[model samples]
Target: MSKKFFEERGDQSAVKAEIIQKYFATWANIILPTAQRYGGGKIAYIDLYAGPGRYKDGAASTPLLVLQKAIENPSLSGALVALFNDMDVNNTQTLQSEIDALLGIEKLKYKPEVNCNAVDHDAEEYFATTKLIPSFTFLDPFGYKGLSLRLVNGVIKDWGCDCVFFFNYNRISLGISNPMVQSHMAALFGDDRAAELRKNVEGVKPALREQMILEELTQALTEMGGKFVLPFRFRNDKGRLTHHLVFVSKSFKGYATMKGIMASASSKADQGVASFAYSPADSSMPLLFELTRPLDDLEGLLKKEYAGRTVSMLDIYESHSVGRPYLSKNYKDVLKKLEDAGDVSVVDPDGKPRRSNSFADRLMVSFPKVKK
Candidate 1:
């Protein structure tokens, strides 16, 4: 974590906190019952690069936010296992103090663990060796050094484990080219792929280069068994891409849940589709939604891809929504349009046209066969 970040609680920081806290509440609620019923009642919240619990202006950071939430929720008070680590001793000390001073902290069944430890190769080895419980890990390393694919894989290897990591675009975009950071880049994308990434990104436009780099990162994660990887972008006050908070999971439910959360926090949306980004620089601009629904493009994609197929709405959403910006609602809306225009048929279980007004996931959607 950067010291400059704690100078004041910026808008980006607030949005980041909102995204994490909001999702944690839902995540805990969904997993808590199952975890208590069968498995160990422990759901972990691991923050690998947790900073001091508060910004200089007295606004609470993530550790405090999480603790406060846990204190409020009776089910989570004893069931949640929190482990917060920071490389800086001062930060760990401060975080310990903050945790101690928090109201109702003593009521938590499992006390929060605060540690001063560097998140490095040794740390990665520990995570790989330890069997983590169902966890929502937040890996917000200061730089690209500790943000390796192995570390990510280690944390998310268990069932119900998911991760949201800070990807410093500015650091990585430049670091990929610097010989000094070659080892770090290799750790992130593997040796051969890192070389290829560097070679491919040379002299490309900034936008294209960013996309290519992210593609490589996404590819690396998927290869490591991270099937669902979602990115939420943050732009600086000047509209320059500064950072990305990437959510990675293997479950469709987690992916869908995050899409809704990220969509709500989006800076711009078009035709009910979310950009999944936060841009303070665009504060003066009005919402980017077009009055006319130009869902022809999405409709065309669905028509061509799913022609001659009959699938449930959930299946369609799970299969097509990942790696695309469209949400379940977006897909439902587009499918409704296609159905209205006679391009496709949506039906109930008995194969008749759907009668309900609600676009339920259980309904079957049948794309028309291609005309001869």
Candidate 2:
């Protein structure tokens, strides 16, 4: 971890913090209400590469923001286990000092634990035997020394657990072809898949190479029971793709929650749809014409899936929205458009018309039957 990164907080850094903060807040709220079903009335927030709590410019980082959120909520204060770890001893020491200075730290049942330890030390050794306490783990390792798929699977193996990691694509992409970093690549994508990934990306264009690597990694995670893996790309000032903030979880709700958060922080939106990326030069680019359309295609999907049947917007969204960029609002907007074209009717549960109003989650959308 470089101390210079904390010297001045950049835009991407700030966006990362905001995404974590917003997701953790929503995650805590959803978990606390139904905590008993998940585990033994406990939850955790783990930060493996926690840096100094505050930047030199006086902006707070994820470690501090998490503690502040814990302080604000009484339920979280009582049940949350805050775990901060760093490979660098200096970073952990500064984080401890910052935690101590946080107001009302003693009100929590479990005090925040700060440790200076190797993140991947015996990671997979005890992963299967030892069950974690339903944690949300954030791995922001410097470079790619300690990152491994096994470590990520360990963190998200337990019930109600999720993970968001910083993936340095630029470094990994460059290193994929190097024999010196073969062992490291194997640790990340597993030995067999890693070899395949390297072979597949060879002699390909830069864009296609990137896609191949991401697809290989996604397939690896999918085999480990991680169904929903979302990546938010970050591009440098020169329009070069840098890295991604990838969120992985087995739960659909967690996927949807993080998707909403990331969508808002995106640098550009095509019409009302978010690109789910941040680019330095994106805002300066002018929108000339429509290259793509909205969820009219979604209307076709809905009609094909539920012809002559009626379903609630919530059900429609939950059942079909996974693995797609379409948001809940996109469903509503598309449904409204369908109603106007007489393809579907939006109504309340009691069969009352809601066509003149906003289409809510609970509102029913009835699709008309098509002739054979």
lDDT of 1 by residue, 135-237 (tens): 9999887777688999999999988898999999999999999999999999999898899999999999998998999999999999998999999999876
What digit string (tens of lDDT, one per residue) describes model 2 on residues 1-372? 458768989989999999999999898888776775656678899998898898999888999998899888888888899988887788889999999998988887898999887866575555546788878889987678788888888888877889999999999997788899998899889999888888888899988887888888888888877889998888876656889998999999999999999999998776577878887768665353235665666777888998999999999998888767778888888888888888787768776655564887888888888779
Candidate 2, superposed: residue stretches over 4 Å from native: 36-39, 287-290, 300-312, 345-349, 352-355, 362-372
Candidate 1 has what TM-score?
Answer: 0.95
Q: Which candidate tops TM-score?
A: 1
Worst 10 residues of 1 by lDDT: 285-294
Model 2: weakest 10-residue lDDT segment is 285-294
List candidate 1 stretches off by more than 4 Å. 285-294, 350-356
Candidate 2's error at 288, in angstroms?
10
RMSD of 2: 2.6
Clashes of 2: 0
